[model samples]
Target: MAYDLAPASVMFADVADVESAEMEIVHWDGGISIVPSGPVITRDADGGELHRLP
Candidate 1:
């Protein structure tokens, strides 16, 4: 016999939004897993904060 291992659902969003706004993770079976660190904020061409993965 074989078993299936996969998350019930997946989601994504901007780190800033997730931090500044309301965020939720709903899973049917398996639990949710979040990265320890969030996206990094760096200066853009115009010197604005840019959110991106590390």
Candidate 2:
């Protein structure tokens, strides 16, 4: 029998800095996945790219 696998939600915390900030990424089957090619960049409310993650 074939089984359907639903999308999975992954969360990553800044363990290096031990900050309260956390990042969440949702993976949908057959959908586009957000893979960070470079360092994680932070953005502002205006959709601007801030500094990269350490």
Candidate 3:
């Protein structure tokens, strides 16, 4: 039997994104080269948001 990976990939990617914390920069790393991190949202490949996690 073969495993379907598309779903798994999406799950793992979201987990990584949230756990990665997108991190916080300190004085030693301060700058405007940052992307703010927030609540995780699951979406379809069409770019339509499906759910925003609480």
Candidate 4:
């Protein structure tokens, strides 16, 4: 018989947002250049930082 392995739990529900870091955005023309780093934070329902992945 085959068994189902479906996930029955919230992966990142209880995970709290500790801090936020910047994700560097790069642009290269002829050489490597660092442009800007965008917001790498997950926001909650009230526009708050939820969980920052990296």
Score residue 1 of candidate 2 by CA lDDT.
11
Q: Report the CA-based lDDT of candidate 1 relative to the real structure.
A: 0.39
- Residue 53 C-alpha lDDT in model 2: 58
Q: Residues 23-45, candidate 2, lDDT per residue (tens digit)?
A: 44444563322234334554434
TM-score of 1: 0.22
* Per-model C-alpha RMSD: 13.2, 12.8, 13.5, 15.1
Tens-place lDDT digits, model 3, residues 1-54: 111334323321132355566633232222212223655554445666655543
Per-prediction TM-score, please? 0.22, 0.26, 0.32, 0.25
Worst 10 residues of 2 by lDDT: 9-18
Best candidate per TM-score, number?
Answer: 3
Q: Please, what are the lDDT tens digits per residue for candidate 4 over residues 1-54?
A: 111223441111122322553333333333222222332343334566545443
Candidate 2: what lDDT? 0.39
**Candidate 1: where are CA atoms >4 Å away?**
1-14, 17-19, 30-54
1-54 per-residue lDDT for model 1 (tens digits): 112225543333345545554433333354443332545333334555533444
The local distance difference test score of each candidate is 0.39, 0.39, 0.37, 0.32
Candidate 4 has its poorest 10 consecutive residues by lDDT at 9-18
